[model samples]
Structure formats: C-alpha cells, structure tokens
Target: MGFRAMVCHRFSKLVLLSAAFISLVVNAAPWPDGAKIAVTLTFDLDAETIWWNDADTMTGNPGSLSYGTYGPKVAVPKILALLEKHDVRATFFIPSWVAEQYPDAVRSIAAAGHEIGAHGVRHVSPLQLTPEQEAATFSESVRVLDRIAGKRPVGYRAPSWAVSNATLKLAARAGFLYSSNMMDADDPYIHNDPPGLVELPVSWVLDDAPYFWFDEDSWNKTIHSAASVKAIWQEEFEAAYHGSGYLNLTMHPQIIGRPARLLMLDEFIGWMKRHEGVWLTTGSAVAVYVRGQQGRSP
Candidate 1:
C-alpha cells in the first residue's frame, strides 16, 4: 500500500478507538461525590406466607408453616442487628399478609430507617393474575403496606423476579417509583413505560434464595456453602466497583439470616466498607438519585 493511504487508514482506526473509549468512560462515570459504584442490600421477607398460602405445595403439610415462620420469628432480628452494626441501610420487600399478621416485625424493620417496598399480597405472582387482577392487587397492596408501615411505599417487586410487560405499566400506575423485577442490566435505568419508572435490576446469582434455601421433605435440594457465597459476592463487587456500576445484592431473612450465613454476610459487608468510593443505599434512594442523574445529563 502507498504510504499516504496507510497513514490515513491508521488515523481513521485511531479515531474510532478513541471514540469507543470515550463512550465507555462516560457510561462508567462515577456516581455522586465521586462514588465509584452503588451497593444496595435488599431482602424479600416472604416468611410462612410463601408456603402456607400455596395449597399445591404446602397444603396439608402444616409443618411447613413452622419452617417458614423462622423468617419473622427468628431470622429478622439477626439480619437487622447485623445491618445496624454495619451502619448500612437496606430495602425490605414484604408480602401484605406477612406484614398484616406480623405488623410488629415489619414495623421493626421500618423503624430501623430501612426502605420498605411492596412484595404483593399473599405472595402471589403477577404472572398468575390477569393484567387487571395484577393491577388491582398492586394497588390494594400499596394501600395495605402503607397503612401498616405508615409510609407510602414507592417501590414494588413482583413476588417472583419475573414480570410481564403489563406489570411495569401497572406498577407505575399504582404509584411506584421503581421496579426491581427486571434484569436487563447490572446498572439501573428508566423503564420505557410512561412516566419512565426507574428499573433496579435483580439477578438470581445475586439473590440469597438460590444459594442458601434448602428443601429436604420434597425437592431435597441444598445450595452452595457460606464460603462460596462470600467469595462469589466479593468477586462480583470487585468487578462492579471497577466498572463503576451498581451492585444490588438480594438477600433473604429466612435464608441468609442463618448464623453462619449471617457471618458470611457480615464478612461481605466488611469487605465493602473497606473499599473506597462505594455509595451504599436502598433501592428507592438509588432510583431517586438515578432520576436526578437523568435530569442532569445534557
């Protein structure tokens, strides 16, 4: 090739590479006050309601209720004390019936200055309901949770992490500021639905249930060890921290609240605290900040 042609081709390649690098830098920019990443600890306190209400799986197996009761009866306080000791704020998503039956328990979580988001009434999945039914359930749940918690919850997560398109619109219409059911990205974004509610993504790998919850009577399944969980979570945190993205770790009082698991959890938090530039907050607070982030962008 001619020298002139070779030089021009090299110049064009350099320009393209520079533009791509610039885009990555912009997308991975630090959060407020130069925080490299945002870390949130969220728990879905399904409790006994997850089993007692499921006639197909839990019906006639009255013993299962006792098994589930560990969440509010024992596990919650352990989880709360740990969080308080760490000086970390978290978000708790509660099913309405659990809150109604265990108002004191739910109230304790709220009292600790943590964000409470709706999980749904009776732990029913929106996928099981007609769109209208889902919308009605969401609206009524918002009302009940507000009454019990004494604050209008601005966030909602479908009983299961899976959600239909209708769920997004219905949640937004029901006065939710964000939905944590979707897993489109590691970082938060605005849903395309009208009013554009913030989308705080969740993943199974980041959840405690798949790793800690065990079944002996039926499925007879057990999950990873506490050491494995702590190691994997730390690995994930390091990657997200360097990318300057958001990390939402989903935990469960009934699962991760076990003494050993709780210790592992504490270890993970201690690791996070030692890391600089990590902004720890609740899912709703993340939504509010992300919305402001959208507004400030040119």
Candidate 2:
C-alpha cells in the first residue's frame, strides 16, 4: 500500500472513532432520578393460545396443551411473586386468546400494577397473514385486552417479532405508544409510517426463550444452561449500561419458570438493582422517556 493511502486510511479511522465516541456522549443523558441505564424486563404470557384452537381443543394431544397451561397456572404467579418481592413492575404481552382462556391471570398481572400489551389473538405470526388479516388480528387483540384489562393497552409486540411494514403501521394507527418487536438498533428510535410511534428494540440474545425453551417432542431441543444465559445477558446489560442506553430483556413464563432458571432470573434482577444508577421499568414507560428525549439533541 502507498504511504499516502495508508496515512489517509488511518485518518479516516480516527475520524470515525471520534464520531462514534461523540455519538455515545451525546446520547448519554443522566436518566431521571439519576439512573445510569434503562432496563425493561418483559414477559410474554402466551399460555395455551400457542396451541389451543378449536381443532386443537377437540383432538389435540392433552400433553401439548399441558405445556401452554403450565405458564399461566404455575409460572406467571411465581414470576409475579418475585416481582412483587422486589417491588418492581414489568410489562406483560398477552395474546387475546390467552387472555380469554386465562382472564384471571391477566387481571392478576394488572392488579399487581404491571403494564399489559397486546401480543396478538392466537399467537400466530403476522407474516403468515395477509395485510387485511393482520390488521383485523391486531384490532381484535387490542379489543380483547381492553375488555379484559379494563384499559386500552398502549403497546404491541408481534409474536416471534414477526412483522411487516404494514403491520407496524397498523399498530401506530391503533395508537400504541411503542412497538417492541424490531431489532434495528441497540436503542429506541421513532417509527413514523403511521406517525409518531416509538420502536423499543428487542434482541433474541436478551430473550430467555431462545436459550431455555427446549422441547424434546418438537424441533427446538437445545436447552442452554442457566449460568450461560445469565452470563450473556449480563454482558449485554453491561454494554447498555456503559452506553447509557436502554436494555429490553424479553422472557417467557414457560421457559424461565423452572426453579433453577427462575433463580437465574432472580439474580439478574438483583444484579440490576445493585447497580446504583439503573432504571428498571416497563417497555411503555421507556417508550415515553425515549419519545421525550427524541426532540432533544442526542
């Protein structure tokens, strides 16, 4: 390589490095009440709806249904109790069918002061539906949640993070404060296709299900150790903490409910709490904060 070219490349890298450092500096604002970073722990209470359609109800294996039933009946309460013990609130995304089947579970989550968001009607992916069907499904899920939770939910998380451009717009039109399904950025950004909706990104690395949800009867059959999952999650949290950005940690009840796994969850929450300058909050609330910050220079 030519000396001049090498010199120019070095200068370019220096400029890029400087720009990156400045970007982080500008985005890092002291969180409200002097928190260092924002943390959102979200649970998808998709019990039974994952496999409880009319056909499944009539002829499905009782054992398949049992996995879904385990979530609401055994897992949610334990998760709630742990949250209650810590006096921390979280966001729970519930499919409409699950809400219909387990209204008491939804009610209990609400009564405990946790935020509820629509996850869909039958736990089906939007990609599988046409635009029209996706719109209808989103509306129906919102309606069911509003009816059962007695308040309109202001957030939406498409199951499996499966979404199309139009599906997100539908969510904005439904008046959601945020959509927690995208993975485009490490932090939140604004989505304005339907106008003024926030995107609080979620990562599979930050989700417990991808690591812990293994079933011998199905294709997914590799359960990771709780310790390994905890280690990676903490590493992600540390990066977010240093960046002074948001961390959206996703979890599912059935996946993280086992005693050993729940202990990992508990310690995760405890670790975050021990970090003196952390804001542990729900997704909707973080959306509010990010929206407020958007207008300001970052």
Using TM-score, give the best candidate's number.
1
Q: Who wins the lDDT comparison?
A: 2
Tens digits of per-residue lDDT, candidate 2, 1-298, equal: 1111000110111111132333222333356777767788899988766655452243355787788788999999999999998889999999988899899999999999999999988878888888898889888988899999988999899988998768788898778889999776676666645556888788889988778776656865687899999899889988887773578888889878888999988998998899878888888887787567653443
Q: What is residue 61's positional error in candidate 2, in angstroms?
A: 2.4
Candidate 2: worst 10 consecutive residues by lDDT? 1-10
lDDT of 1 by residue, 1-298 (tens): 1111000110111111132333111222246677778898999988876666563364535676776788899999998899999999999999887888899988999999999999988777777889988888787888888999999999888887758758888888888999998765677766545455888888888888888777755776777899998888888998887763678988878888788999999889988989987888999888887766553322
Clashes of each: 0, 1
Off by over 4 Å in 1: 1-29, 53-60, 217-220
What TM-scores do the predictions have? 0.87, 0.86
- Residue pairs in collision within model 2: 36-277
Residue 67's lDDT within candidate 1 is 66
